[model samples]
Target: MLSTIVLAFQRWDGLSARRFTGLDNFAFLVKDPTFWQSLENTVVLFLMSTVPTLVLALILAVMLQSAVRFTNVYRIAYFIPNVTSLVAMAIFFSSIFSTNFGLVNAALRSLGIPQQDWLGQPWGIKIAISTMIVWQWVGYNTLIYLAGLQAIPKDQYEAAKVDGAGVVRTFFSITLPQLRPVVLFTVIMSTIGGLQTFTEPQVMVGNSGGTGQSGMTVVLFFYRAAFLDNDYGYAAAIALSIFALVLLFTAINWRIFRGRSEDR
Candidate 1:
């Protein structure tokens, strides 16, 4: 963190003599259209990927918590993506979203839909990236939620049932409230993961970030600046920007969740 702050004030690549350029990097970030585009894409990816992941993970967790056949097998299957290499996963997804002969487009074509170049447009790139994000993290979030669900004593359900509570009633009146901590945990994790997205775009669209740089995320932008452009100071500013963004969102999340807990 300190290194980033220091780098913000100096105009030096990793190999160059350092020159003090205090506030110039920050100024450049504010004025750069690409930076703003990256910021927008980052936020969009964060929300689009995160909301679905939480809902899906919770649903999966609840299902797994119930009596089911081959429960361990199911869990392992879901968790494989989370433990797999992200670079490999990103590469695979690039193939899946490829323009001419991708799996996704092929499936769509089979359904009598027109094939779209998913990596060629802003929304398409975002959708592709978000899909990767959700697929990668949903299992991890599910496992965390499963742990939380298991930590909830079985007696709570029995007590709720004994008191004439239905399945929905038991879930809302006991399960969700008990899982509040886990919900908060997932939200915060999602916040971080969503913002720090890098590998997907890097491997999917290269540093150019596809058409109009739609796939350019903040971290990827930072990587471009630090490595491709050799603007270390600017890269440092972007890094600090990401740190601040994450911190801000995390605080907002805490407040929202903390208020919910207080209400409970």
Candidate 2:
């Protein structure tokens, strides 16, 4: 591992290896418009997935925890997508978002709306990627939340009920507070996953990341620069940038969750 790390920093046979560039590679990355664009795209996709995914997962977990009939069946159904092949799922999404024969376009046309060119537009590609992320991860998050919910003692709910607290009040006062650690775990994991998202977009939009490179995440950009374009120095710099971004976001999330825990 140490040798590999050293090798990454020192390019042996390339033009970049002739002399140490210090922080020049990083500086070039900052100046690159595509790098900035890819960063922006990653942030947008993260927002599109993280918020709704957590919210829906929490709701599903709570519902599943209740003694509803067929709860096991529901859990199995929700988790199926998470275990499915990502490439196959991406292909399925591609068909659903197809401009002409896609289910989405077909629905739009039926509603008297013009068919959208989903893969050919920037926001559209981001939305499509977001949809895939949400679909793929919501189940896993739901299971995490369900486990957290199960861990909460039943006596607490009984006590709240005896104190004349309604279900909503008890949920807000007891359930949510108790779930903080689980929520923090999910948020941190999601931050790491969101920052490194590549497969769905790559499969759905191909290696170039679709029209205008809207679907080109930081990792995808790094892959293209390093492997496809053979610019290892710049790719290493991009990799470090991605690492920094993930660290920054994860730290922010930890701070936020830590504060909430302290307040509780």
Candidate 3:
């Protein structure tokens, strides 16, 4: 990390002698439109994937918790994607969302809808990447939420039942409140994962971030700068910036969840 910080201020192509450039790299970064674009795409993808994943995971966890048979089987099935190789999954999703002769477009056509190019448009690219992220992580998050649900004391549910609480009421009042810490854990993990996303977009859309650069993410941007452009200094700067951004966001998450816990 220290090496990266020092490198951020120096210009060095991997093969050339190092020259100190001070903040020149950062100065250029401020004027670079692509940097801003990549940041926006990262946040957009984060929101697009994390929100749906969490909501779906919670719903699935609740349902799984209520199941009386084959609980382990259901849990294992949901978790399979999380352990699967991401590059392979990304390639699979690429085919699924392919512009023509893809399952998604074929299904849409069967419903009398025109086939939309999934990778040829900006929003489509972002959507495809986000969908891949959600698919890969939702099951992992489901298992996390399931673990939290299982850890809840039975007395709480018994008490809620004794009070004539409906399922929804009990869930919102007892289950959710008790699971706050677990939710916080998942939120922070998801945020970090979202910010550092690389493999999915790289595999699905390539290092250039696909058409219109819509799938560009912060980490991918840094990777391109370092490996492709060979601008080690600028790449180091981007990497440090990403680290700071992740730290800032993680602190924000801690404060928000901690504040809520205090209030309750």
Candidate 4:
């Protein structure tokens, strides 16, 4: 596997490998407007999806931890999406976001609101893609958080109750602090997943990310460079750049969470 990969880099003629132009591809990527646009879109989607997903997952996990009825059934339902095929989900979402006769538009029309061309507009396409990502991953995160919540000793909550701490107070002061490591883990995982988002956007908005390339994630951009445009060297550089970005963002998340825990 390593030899095949190295040979692709060493002898690949598709990207003018005969002349080793060190950093040329990297320089082009730095100045590429499309690359920057994709980066911006990626960040926006990450923020939009990760924040809400984590918040909702935390809430759901808390509810489930309270000896709720049918807890096992709920767990299975939430985890179904994680086990389901992403490609199939993407395809399903694409049909739902169609400009005409889509479920969203039909519902809007029933409410006397104007229908939207979801996949035809840049921001709309982004929202659609982000929605899919959130829907699919929120359940998985919830399960992880639920596990973390279950691990917390019952004595802590019992003691908090005896000390006259309200439910919210105990949650904020006790539950949240204990879940810091789990939260950090989810954040880092989401960061890595968000940075490499490709299929939903690609399948939903097509190759160029619909209007103005709004839904074009960095991964899609890399795919285009390497496969569609046949620029192997540039694509490899973009891949490395993505790796660097993921590392940077993961480090930032870890530092922020670690600092917040220590501050408390």
Candidate 5:
């Protein structure tokens, strides 16, 4: 972190002599339209990815918590994406969402549905990347939720059942309230990961972040500034901005959850 802060003041291409540029890099970032675009895209992707992920993960956790055949197999299957190589998975998804002659387009065309350029268009690219994010994280979040589920005394469910509470009623009144701490952790973690998202976008869309720069996440923006543009100072500034953004969001989420916990 200190190294990044120091680098933020020095204009040094990796191979060139360092020139102290002070706040110029930061000033330039302020006016850089692409940087702002990337920031916006990052936030959009965060919302697109994280919300459905938590919902699906919670549902999966609840389903798996009930006794089921091949439960362990189901758990491992869902978790494989979380443990797989992100670059490889990104490449795989790129093929799946490929504009022409790809499986997705082929299937769509077979059904007489128009094939959209998944990675070529702005919104499509964001959706594709967000899909990858959800797939990668859902299982991990599921496990965390499952742990929280286990911690809830079995008698809570028994009591609810004795009171003639339905599954839906019990889930909202007992399950979610008890899972607050786990939800808080997942939310903050998802926020940080979403803001720092890089690999899937970079791998699927290339360094330029595809058409309209929709795949340009904040971390990807930092990578291009540092490596492709050889603007270390600017990259450092972006890095700091990313850090600040994460910190701010995490603090906000913490306060919201903490307040709820206190109220409860």
Candidate 6:
């Protein structure tokens, strides 16, 4: 941590002598268009993945909680993706989203939809990376939600059932309200994970972030600067910016959830 802060002020290209540049790196960062673009892409990917991931995870958790047959098998199945190697997952998704001769395009063709390039376009790149992130993390989150569901008092559900409440009604009135804290935890954790996204995009699109840098993320941007470009000082500054962004978003999440609780 201290080294990063020091490096942020000193310019060094790994093999060269360290020269103190003070805020020069930061100033250049302010004027760097790619940095801003990467920031925007990061946020876009974060929202693209995090929202659907949590929603699907919560729904899966609810279903799993009610399962009576092959319960352990189902739980293991859902969690398999989380434990699988990320590189392998990225490669697998890359094949799935390939522009030509891919299952996704094939499926679209079968459904009478026009086949679209999944990795060659800007939006498609973001979607592909976000989908990979969701697939990787959703199972872990589902298990978290399942644990929270299990911890809820059985009496609350029994009372709702006795009152002739339907599954949908009970889920909203009883289940959701009780899971507020768990939901908040998941949201914050997702925010952190989303902002730090690196491997999927790097693997899927390469270090250049693909055409027009649409797939560039903050961490990937930093990695490119530090390693590929040998701009370690600038990379350090970028790292600090990433930290600040994560902190800001986390605080926002905390406040939003805390306010809801107070309102209740």
The models' CA-based lDDT, in order, is 0.92, 0.89, 0.94, 0.86, 0.92, 0.95
Which of the predicted structures, 5 or 6, would earn the higher lDDT when compared with the native? 6
lDDT of 2 at 37: 86
Give residue 134's error in model 6 in angstroms: 1.3
What TM-score does each of the candidates earn?
A: 0.96, 0.93, 0.98, 0.94, 0.96, 0.97
| Model with the higher TM-score, candidate 4 or 5 | 5
Task: Give the Å shift of residue 130 in candidate 3.
Answer: 0.9
Residue clash pairs of candidate 5: none
Model 5 — which ten-residue stretch has the worst lDDT?
67-76
lDDT of 4 by residue, 13-43 (tens): 4745354665567678889999999999999
Best by TM-score: 3
Instruction: Find the number of clashing residue pairs for candidate 1.
Output: 0
TM-score of 5: 0.96
* Runs off by more than 4 Å, candidate 1: none
- Relative to the unseen true structure, what is the C-alpha lDDT of residue 107 in candidate 1, on a scale of 0 to 100? 94
> Clash totals for all models, in order?
0, 0, 0, 0, 0, 0
lDDT of 2 by residue, 1-264 (tens): 343334345443445444465667777788999999889999999999999999999998988888569988888999999999999999999999999899999999999999999999998999999999999999999999999999999999999999999988999999999999999999999999999999999999988988898998999998998778877767777887898899999999999999978876
**Residues 1-264 of candidate 6: C-alpha lDDT, one tens digit per residue:** 999999999999999899999899999999999999999999999999999999999999999999999989988988999999999999999999998888999999999999989899999999899999999889999999999999999999999999999999999999999999999999999999999999999999999998899999999999999999999999999999999999999999999999988999
Clashing pairs in 4: none
Scored by lDDT, model 4 comes in at: 0.86
The residue ranges of model 4 lying beyond 4 angstroms of the native Cα positions read 1-12, 15-17
Q: Which residue pairs show collisions in model 2? A: none
Model with the higher TM-score, candidate 5 or 6? 6
